[model samples]
Target chain A: MGAHTMEPASSSWVTLLGDSDRRGGTTAARNTAPKELLWKVTLGDSIRSSPVLAAGVVLVTCRDGHLYAFDARTGRERWSYATPASVHSTPSLSGDLVLFGCDDGAVYAVDRTSGGLRWKAQSEGAIWTSPSVHRGTAYFGTHGGVFNAVDILSGRTQWSRRFDGRIHSSAYATDDRVYFGCSDGCVYALASSTGADAWRYQTGEGVTASPAVKDGLVLVGSEDHVFYALDAGSGAVRWRFQTGLGLASSPAVTAGKVFFGGKDGHVYALAVADGREIWKSPSIRQITAAPLAGASLVCVQGFFGTTQAYDLNTGDTLWTASLGGSLGSTPVITDDTVYLATYPGVIYALR
Target chain B: MNRRTFVYNAALGTLHVGLLGTQLRAFQNTPSAPTLQIDIQAPDLPLSKLAMPGLFPGRVVQASHAGSLLNGRVQQAPVGQMLDQGMRALTGESTSKEAWAKFIEPSDIVALKVNPSGTPTTTTSIPLMREVIRALNAVGVPNRNIIVFDRNSNQMEVLGYHNLLPVGVRVVGLDGDWAIGGRTRPGYDPNVFAEMNCFGERETRSYMGSVVSEASKIINLPCLKEHNASGVTGCLKNLAYGCFNNVARTHRFPKTYTDPAIAVLCTAPPLRAKAVLHIMDGIRAVYHGGPFAWNPDFVWEAKTLLIGTDPVAVDRIELEMVEQKRRDVGAPSLWDRNPQNLGSAADMDRSAQKNRFYREPGHIKTASELGLGRWELEQIELRKLQIS
Candidate 1:
């Protein structure tokens, strides 16, 4: 059975980059990469969509056009929902539904438990980013340059706005604004209620990376090799930190520090308020996905097979282990365990 | 003049009589002025302030890294190093960033036209692309202004161009000027097009991609591959075929219009003025089965990066390297026109020594004659570097 609850009665991850503690808190303070492999399963294709966990089930999307559910403890396949094209969008759980966008230009809601299709709302172009569900609505962007806000219950489009570029960046919603990156090289703050452009800050390049909002500031990375912190209300750049390469991964904030990875092959931690460099790990190859920031440690996957975890405070390498295949997705941390997916379609459960 | 089979074939027959050499010589017989009916029309747009053969005219840099490829996979460090060295040498600048500033500006929307149709076997190396993006960033070009694009979005996605580059830099694949067959699509500019009637096709115009048309400058990143239609697929050919829509019609089986079309396309406004740099990726190249590395045996790691503002000059050097590789492999050169030497049309991989068309490797020379860049090998100052 599926349930729609944040920080449920136990430690679980409800969304991409979502996690809870043993106290049933919403903070994904996962501090370490577990040493032992619990179970590992290979999907039909590469796992670009990060895994979301709830109710002892691990949900992951694959380029094979399927949303697969596996027993978290056993790594045994429970069910899988197939789509016409690949699913690059990570799954967002709403009640009993698992919602995501697909390469076929449609957003589908599948029953989380049975992996059966609930409803499909179509867009004119391919959807490469995940749906951000807030206030009973799902928000996402499409290659057609249209960002759609659909009702979570009925999978019906409530409103849409067309931009000059595709919305490859997923949405991060605040109380009033939904922040997302656009191909036109701008980070937009759209009104959550009306889908109107509240304010936009242009970056040097497209903003494919999602915004991570905290304390009135929205943090996102641009292909311009710089990470920016913008004011949530006015979209003004408060501070910007240049990286060695372009940023693809979203920032993870914990204890006033933000951690993110760059295409330049380093894991970086900077002050969230001023965008000053606190510490940066040595070059480790290109990191494409967001690092899983727990309370004490932040974990990132190299484009290659190795996954490394560093201390959130000192940026010291805490642990390094191979996750079997080249990692194209982010590391997902749940209470007591860590999940890493690879481009070759392998999913590893380490505890 | 629209290049016709009668004129192209007759000229080749006459040229072949005196040219007991490679196919590049075939282009020499092709006069600078066309005898065929061909028309090139660019939109009434502002010409690029920075045009081809920029900074150093007739100069080319060959940067080779011994560790550019590891077990056939692209090595990032060596690729990045090679780019830095190549850019520094090409611009005679002390740093790569300073060199990039010679052509690219902070406000300019630079299009990095990539060759990605070949997919996994060979395309623009991802590592080199990253370095180019980084270099552009170093010069203060916003990631939004630096576009990594190809004609086919499908091929670009398959090659991981979107994932390979940093976020914020636009990785766009327009699919083509035409979405389905030869029909016009929004991705193509209705204003700018190359008009030529080939094979009696009703649609004679191939539009310049809307993405490239919108950009202020272009940096060509083409792969070192042979084309079944055009013998030498280099910088000019990449821009000619990669940016224009409905280009496949230029070559039907054994016939081709790539020679005049490619050279003339480069001479057209907008493209001629916007395209300022050419970097040919020869790190992993296809000596045969070009356009695509259809055969693994034909793909080799040349570990070379050809950089220059003169597309024609860089392409000429690339062709010679491919020719030399063909010689080493005991395979017929791309210029070999002996139909008897061609493998079965059904399967070229079976007989690795195969000729798809009397490949117009001479397109490089034709482009040179069209005033694109230096075509004569003796005129080009090639600076070769073996990166330790």
Candidate 2:
């Protein structure tokens, strides 16, 4: 691993940035719904990957067999790098390098500022999960059921461990451990230093949902429809909540409330302690987007053109809007702006 | 109007067969007892000239045949001649179904289960799809009553299917709005899908599918291709694509009845066994990435169309072509690399690596064993029509 420093830069509130992750639309930050469509740029093919904003540049991966960088506000083509196959993984920014996995079974690191290529590490299967960085260690899962830990700067492999199935879930990083789940029905905690297994807990079915850790407790959901809270250090199950269906959406923890969506067409808020139910709201359709929480608002997106914001405490509706298409992307909230993506190849910015 | 009149004449003949007692012998000769094993013995006459026997009598009759010319072992002919022979071999009746159904009313709906997921180059051709629609229309099957469906939206769009079909002949996809509306309430299993089997055990799952069940007659238009997991995807593959929520789950246990499960799921009493006619599109064969073509090189242009009511027989024949291609390419058979034979669950063998093409599709054999159709090539009447 090498010493790394990510430049601190800001993106203007005027333009929309990022890849068409999940769905195509991105929410804009404004008092009124996005009116001024920034510059729209066309690539070679449809983009299924999400875009991440860092250092004033938007890093996007496209099915057109390229990883692209553009000015966040201007949508001007900055630079582009071609790959062997599709890049479905959303690029994660770590310092000056952007890390992403491609369908060609390789993890690539590119210069975030210059859009220049850095280093590439190969995997057995395609990498659809975004690489999560922590303490100079980068972690991500692959289609071949392997979780790899690589040095972010040099792209050297630290260690690799195999599971029973594919790993579509992205990695979550804390201080010493990188936690994630796989299609093999197991959630694993590995030491970020050497990729050695710290702990593993099996679920009923596959665990494609990502994990979110806070304060020594790791919260994650599984395809088995069970939401689990594990001991951050030992990977022991602290509490598990059984939903009516498989849980694909990652859990978002705020205060004492854990918000997530179940495939049974319901968005649930559960007490993080002992896995008790708090309040449940029936989404009009299956909720694929992870829930985003602000001060008093819980924003949820559904697969069938619906997005709603509810009062965090009482489950009261704050606002509801039809996006005119299915939305699979998680909404990112920044002050007053909420950004999301839809399937019809358009991103919407809602204020 | 002439074709409609011919259908009317055929319907009158069918009525006469129903009324007369002499037709019982023709029905007795229909060969209802399903043949199990494959016999290599050649039939007495050439299959092309032979009139293929029918399974059901009064209701079903032969429609016109359709075929495409190939470079080797086949010749090219006019479109009308090629389509007529192919349609004749497909329907097996001398006249259209509308003519034979004058005494009995014609069906209101016809579902065409198309293979949009096959390799792009070898997928069902637009001409073939158009001919099927045209022939059905000649039999008085209205355009509004016809529907062509597939598993994926992108695949259907790639094959240029949306533009080929007439406006009345709706083309539907799995992810499309109309198909999504067909989704029912969540079954016993809480998976994202609408249906489920029993808990804790994996067996043949029984669930309601509006598209599969509601069709008056199903015309399965599947592309013949090599499948990495299921051995070969053909008419039987349609069952998997048409019924299940997530097909990737079927690969959990290797060689575990994926092919047979699809066949059983469709052939079992209520789900589909009633009204299905398979039209295997061999226009372009995907010798390899299959189910989805990632590599364009693996595709080959084998212009042929295979029609059969029995899915097992159709797939067995198709699988034979895949095996021959692999053999010609000097590669291993699907059996040699079958992943199911890997390290046992009881013994974790560190050296165990998954065989890429692991496991022969047991479904066809199992389907044959269940008394569906003949597995051997000898029993099938291979009608090699010279389209040119």
Candidate 3:
């Protein structure tokens, strides 16, 4: 089979934590509060993967070890394929193939249209990071400290690197480099083509948050309670902001503003240039997942199971909806719908 | 008669419940009736077999000190002394140090699996944990090697356990990140798990905590309490549910009993092999409204500590003690769910009436069936001592 290389439409979210850049920043505008409810579907178990919309289908993985595809508008079950173990890794769409890793230590490529297995490549440990597919190569890391670059079409390893600790951070791929965080408390930048180490920035604690690279700054958070921005080329620290506790939330950069949630339960908006706090919201419970920055509103899913939307420019609270269960997955923002998943296996499509 | 009626009759000490033929036959050969005979022979059996006498065989030591608790706090000195006497009695060793040496060594990394759930009054007392640490230290296990842990980090933090323990004694909460992600943190070892399809749950496997897999030995420290779902939660439930992740999926709506699940978990190779000691804190026992401590009226100064290697045997004794306490308070039996007695103090003061599920105290016997330990009253030799 030939590799499908259709560019995602500007409005589609085709990868985990938004696009392959892992920016989680969207430009699609939508009403903050819609009067009507869309549709909701229950899955087999809790979901930790953010939903990705590709070609009118919403794709999400469940703790029950299944990847489910639902009709985006109607919430009808399209198809589901089960893996050997639970999947926390969000799926990346590459043409007609869906690529994701599983806790069973295998990276799978499934046909998007028929839900059939295309190819599977085994890894040494459980994969918690979503695959970042760039130029027909899938890049991801596993808990076993193995970072792999697999060919998307044939499911063959191009190159693999070993680290000292687990990797939970998904890779953010640019034209030349891929950036990710590791449990060994380091943010690593590697060449996209050869899987060679480009630069490594050490943090005080483990780095589980995926890197958000905008302009020339690489922004990531560490469990050491510090949010760091480093020079993308030199790996030198540009600025660091300390919070009350550690941070596992990835930053969402949009419109010259960087938005991130902290383990201390506060959401902070900072200037992308100098890392100055623009606004800090009150404690909304521990924010572990990345904040979704849409055109006019910034939506954050708190670990306490509430999804709240704030004014993107003012950081003012716009609307909040309780999912009634813990949420580890990031929220998906479309032009008309915001898809959120809760730990109790319920997926809510709110417009 | 229905199974419920038979259980009610059995709880009332009626002899006419013909439905209990198996139990009647099992009890007929017991010469001491309620008093258990000591059986020390360790049986060789498969993992599926339920008749292993290897877990402390037939002995259980219960040491009671009247002044162990004062002003709702456990006196460390008296509890330590009581622990010493109980260990001596349980192991047949003359001194506490000698008895402790039988179970632990200097080079071993010991994990003290403490139950930190429920209210302050019903949770494992910090004083008792100190005593356990002291005993471990006396046996030459270093402070760094001693880990005091519970399932939830937040609950342990809420109970002030992190600050209460000794400086070098590492306190860990296994599921610290559960609230954040719903998935248990990396603290659970994925390699070691108990897989069983109970009640058709989606997550059929319960992974053992990393502490259990890493430690050379585990000392199960459970508090004495009446669990609304499990009837009574003592040694078996503590090590079973406490040491494993994803156990809440076992007993959900429509069916709330953790019978086979608890037994399967406790008998899992990782726990069944590593867990060598069972020390149940009964100083403040809750006859009702527990696992969580909300109703003070149902709580009392039990002033007792049950120590044994046989979790099932210890749990069986705890079950009888809780049943007696429930009877003394005019509460319905754990098995007989009479909704008519809903507003009583023993029924979680009626606040937890709707939340309460069908109780499954028979998990102790189920563990015994799985060859985890002895559960029958006739098979257990209980040594009751007063350490004043």
The residue ranges of model 3 lying beyond 4 angstroms of the native Cα positions read A1-10, B1-274, B277-388
Q: For residues B1-388, what per-residue lDDT tens digits would candidate 3 score against the true structure?
A: 1110011112222222222233532233232222111111111223322122334676889999999976555677889888999999998889999998878899988989988777345788777887888888898998778877777764564344543355446566675322111233456766666554545557666667777766778888999899877888898888878987777775654345476567655645556667778889999898887887565667889899999888888888999999898788777788876654434334455543333565778778767766677887999999999988
lDDT of 2 by residue, B170-221 (tens): 5555453342223432211222122222112354333333454445566777
Candidate 1's clash total is: 17
Residue B246 Cα positional deviation in candidate 1, in Å, after optimal superposition = 28
lDDT against true structure, model 2 = 0.57
State which docking tier applies to candidate 3. Answer: incorrect
lDDT of 3 by residue, A1-351 (tens): 122224333347777667776656566665466556699998876677788877788888987789999998999998999986768788888878998899767998998988899999998766878888877888999877789999888999999999876787888888899999886678999999888989999986578888889879999888667899999998999999888665777788888888888856788999989999998888874677788887788888876668888888888888888874343577787676778887678888887
Better of 1 and 2 by TM-score: 1
Fold similarity of candidate 1's chain A to the true chain A, as a TM-score: 0.93
Candidate achieving the largest lDDT? 1
**lDDT by residue (tens digit), candidate 2, A1-351:** 121223221121111112211211123222233334455566665444455555555566775568877765667778988887656676776666778898667999988667788999998766868787777787888876678988877999989987766787788876677888876578888887777789999986667777777666888887556799999988888988877655767666666777887655578887877678878886454564567654565667665567777666766666776764332355544443444444454444444
Instruction: Mark the 10 consecutive residues where model 3 chain A has the least summed lDDT.
Output: A1-10
**lDDT of candidate 1 over B55-158, digit per residue (tens):** 56689999999898765456778889999999999887898889889888899889999998765548887778888888888999977677788877645654
Share of the reference A-B contacts seen in candidate 1: 0.00
Task: Write down the lDDT that model 1 would get.
Answer: 0.75
